[model samples]
Target: MNADNNLYQLYQSIELENVILSYKGEFTSELLTALIHILEAKMEELGTDFRVRKRVFNVIIECFQNLYHHIDFYDFRNEKLEVRKPALIIVKYKDGDFIVNTGNYVMTKDVPKLEKRLSFINTLNKNELRELYLEQLNKGKISSQGNAGLGLIEIARKTKEKLIYNFVKKDSKISFFSLKVVVGN
Candidate 1:
């Protein structure tokens, strides 16, 4: 993925890459509500099975909420919060499955650490992932951004699919982190 300062440019590139569903804008509470509606409609339009729709919705919620809690930014001009930092949700339709692609900006210094955690988690089976998630949650430890970090682990456990991730250098000190998750019917 090409990294640019402009989010619109990122959105365009993702679309050109064959993204089926996307929303590129501020990740406000309002926008999150709209996204739920859009996704619900899209599932209906696609005629996805009821059971599969629920799984899709749950995964999307967890992924977006992670971005909502992390992926920091600030707006100096207006003294406001600029939480709209290049977040995406791409759904790729295949013959018998769907893949969800998501991404946002993360600090370059933290990429290696995050990669290690993701790699370790990816090696675990569903039971191991669940155990790890519960262990972390019981510790009540917070992440660098004050999140529980359990969400990602829980996502992996719930989906039972290997989480695919890549970190691309966006600039001197920041990286663009992307993740792809697959679900089959």
Candidate 2:
């Protein structure tokens, strides 16, 4: 889902009512920084309160980092091969709510596990989410990708909203995961 230069420009140019910040290419440190800066500027222009902005930033950082650390990308050029993992994020800022969508490739076998995690997180109340997050953090153990699923739980708690997800088929072996969270002021 690579974006053309024109579309990217249009996205940057307009003061969108429902702004959708999408990342569909290589997820380098540089790209991630640029996205965060632009999003911050846009939120500032929208007159968002400091608390809301802080929460939004935290969610964005965690979401993007999770994708960056967990995804793998492969490249083949001139009979040489290189691999990299890329993450795609789409953040939509709508009236009274911010919708964050992020996606990354995952092994086919991991689908059920991810789904279960999402389901569990979505069902928790604020107190339960906080308890779960503290529990995970106090344990001080990290996952294979250096994550403890706290990001998802944090998004759920901060938003006080449901987390919606979709799995799109990318190929025989890999799948694209889309997660959307809405935080309302």
Candidate 3:
């Protein structure tokens, strides 16, 4: 009875938020693909505008790829495998806009660099962002994980909004990074 009540409450909460879809767990490639398909179907069923749907889909892809590549799998000391690399993603509708919120675990040491990058990106105008994106793309800069490091920039470009983020310390070694992007309809 308690479990059922809790589930009902959760469902009501989701309804209140107008959430279209949500996932919380390991972010694997297979799961990413499945999520993309599901979201596409939902968007279609909702009759979302093509441009809005494209922008939202692009940002979601970038967010998921950021989680896939940058998530820390081991402890800060690089000693043992962390039990779970949990991630959360929620797509919701509010005021004729689609909001995407994604959360993942990151190593504490990387937080500063991530903060700096996001801060810099936030300072740019649309034209400046486009120039930077093209410049980076032309350079073909690739990270150790084979990502070109353009996910953040592309996300910002697609959403045309400043990325809202929070880093909550989970422990001494890890922090949970949450990012929110909004796309206007």
Candidate 4:
């Protein structure tokens, strides 16, 4: 009964929030591609401007990459729960702006570095972000997973919006990291 009511409240909230898409499950390349297509159709239906649609797609791809690459399942501390730590992606359109929110579990120890990096990114203007993105590209340090560590930077540059995040401790070792990015003026 409680769960039903909770879900009902959630449904009501989603309605009020103007959410266009919401997914909370394990992420994969195929699923990500499907999500992009779904949003592409939505943009088409709404007659979104070409430039704004491009920005929206760029930001969503980056967010999906972060979810795909940065999940820290090792910190889950339970073999039973290690199958797949589900992540979340929520897209909302409100007042001519599209808001994206992605959440995933991360190792608590990584919180400080992530917080610092995002804080620095938030402080930079569009010009500075471009410079930093180019500098990072020049460095060319790609991870084993093939990430060049430029997803956040690219998101910020494309959106020209501050990256908003919150780290909520889930346990002693694992925390939920939620990031929100806004695209369109």
TM-score of each: 0.77, 0.79, 0.92, 0.89
> For candidate 4, what is the TM-score?
0.89
Please list the residue runs of candidate 3 whose C-alpha ends up more than 4 Å from where it truly belongs after superposition.
Answer: 72-79
**Best of the two (1, 3) by TM-score:** 3
lDDT score, candidate 3? 0.87
Best by TM-score: 3
Cand. 2 TM to true fold = 0.79
Instruction: Residues 123-147, candidate 4: write the lDDT tens digits.
Output: 9999899899999999979987788
TM-score: model 3 vs. ground truth: 0.92
How far out, in Å, is residue 106 in model 3? 0.6
Weakest ten-residue segment in model 2 by summed lDDT: 72-81
Q: Which stretches of candidate 1 lie over 4 Å from their true place?
A: 1-18, 73-84, 142-146
Q: Lowest-lDDT window of 10 residues in candidate 4?
A: 70-79
Order of models, best TM-score first: 3, 4, 2, 1
